[model samples]
Target: MPTDIAFLAIAEAQQLYHWLPAALELARRPGVRVSVLSPSDQLLALVASYDPQGILRPVRLRRPPSRPDSLFRQPSRLATLLLNYATIARFPTLVTTEISSAWLRRVPGFTSHLILIKHGAGDREGGYKKRHADFDLTLVAGEKDRRRMIDRGLCTPEAIAVGGYAKFELKAPRQRYFYNDDPVLLYNPHFDPALSSWVNHGPAILASLESLTGWNVIIAPHTKLARAAAPIVSHAPHIRVDMGSRHSIDMSYTMSADVYLGDVSSQVYEFLLHPRPCIFLNLDHRDGAGDAFAHWRLGQVIDSADALPQALARATGLQPGFVAAQEAAMQESINLSLVPASQRQADLILNFAQTSHPAKS
Candidate 1:
């Protein structure tokens, strides 16, 4: 039988849009045939569009429209345990963002390798300990995250790393393009109510930006913002809130923007790949909460809507030394490159798939 590699992605719209295609390309090497198994229509379209020749097969799983209590309350490990076995039966190599050790137990021919790409904060790795078991390899993009995974006994030292951010491997530019005609500010708010400025101050921020002149604002919010009932800036001439319908996950906005405004979303890290100045919003400064990014000391962290205008002023007038420092720190944290990150990731996946054999027991 031909070597088949299956990539399981979250049913969520944005995750599918931004993360899935990169994984597909990484898997489509000489020995492997890649398939994307996801529930989001956006994901299906990306797979089809990225490889119209049917080079990568797109498989849509039947999933309930409304999220179930079990899945919603406890995601990551448990959710992966429930949905991944079906994919294991058809494909020997599995690449996923969320992997459950519990699911690995039940697969009939389960010797296949699993490579997990960690996409969130370091704190989210707590559940991995409960489901801990052996896997071929695991990749992480953040150093703090790699440490947490190691401390939790989730995977071995060799299996984890502050590996390069996967999206860094995708489309990138030789040098950041900054247009002096008008400063471009990209606002990316997290979807989580407790962690996002959009949940609390989006309307106020939108209204404030609407009144201001000069800076061009691109509100590329979390994809979930598209379906939010109390959504921010439904239709604004100046704002471009991501609808997820028309946009694919290109990081051009990150490369070109002069400044970034965001909450606790990982998109901020993506924006930081180019080492631009950013402003972080602190909606709830619940002290000792231990969201390390909040204390990252990379940029200004503001606590109110009123401070935004001044923050924008400082961002626009950033000194050359300050810009250099922030960019250097961000480079150490994200470790991105325009040339080889994705291609190396692609090579790793293909090499693993070719060398590993199926389970005998």
Candidate 2:
């Protein structure tokens, strides 16, 4: 029996590193109870270990949709409405990311208010707006993103607040880079072809760097790369493919890197937090394209693999300024002052619970 409000979180194993702590903290609030629906077993195991006290209730989601790319995709409108009805039966308030918010709104008690928590670039697309339109309040990682959201068309324009980088604000620093060591480069490629991929001659760019032993490279491809079951990357003596390392949940590698190499990924924002040199592959150079948010202004965007050599040369040459620019952009994009954005998010959940006035069990 729920005495106050039931908060729901839709999570996965690879995402537990960020969501679990936030879930646990949210559960600690006096009038709030936190429950989770995880799509993977690994996430279940992690929640058990992380919150042995059983503060978090766990639920199983329906079988994942058939399409490989659809795992995180929003469900059909009908499906979303049904899920919302089911949640409404058990909880007074619902708190979730953009994907799950629409469905949860079908729950009767959540009619007057909803809260949307934007996780990454994925949320910035259609996924967030679909559900967030119902939100009485919304949380964003920073001011830049809040403007971006407003431009995208979310409801109640005044409802949005800079939540800071919620994911980073929740975790302990994995490790920090020490100076004078051989710099480590984290090459994180997005899974979208429209953005960056081997189709854009990624191998050629890698081949160009074979002679340079100045840095160790960790190739943390998007998780989808691992789903292929085939070799996502051919071995390189200098390049290590971290197929097993879960960036969806853990970002220590991104946190520690002295340099970042990628196209456009939200991880770039995290990398920018520490201020580092970064290189981008401008496969299509969509900087001025109608979709401006798709363009990441963080680093040098090279159009061809042949140009990588010069980009690397420039990155190493102007390391200080490069790091500063990344850091400055990060500050511009997010509100670092909102330490523990997740906690602030939890407080919003509590406020929703109070407003809803759930009936006694």
User: Considering every candidate listed, which one attains the maximal TM-score?
Assistant: 2
lDDT string for model 1 (128-231, tens) is 55444455666665565666667777777866655566655454453323343567778877666666677777777787667656776777776655446364
Worst 10 residues of 2 by lDDT: 66-75
Best by lDDT: 1
Write model 2 residue lDDT over 122-146, tens digit each, in one string. 3224334455666666777667667
Output the worst ten-in-a-row residue range by lDDT, candidate 1.
Answer: 66-75
After superposition, candidate 1 runs with Cα above 4 Å error: 16-28, 39-42, 60-87, 100-112, 120-135, 142-144, 161-163, 172-181, 225-229, 234-237, 246-248, 286-291, 294-296, 319-321, 337-339, 355-361
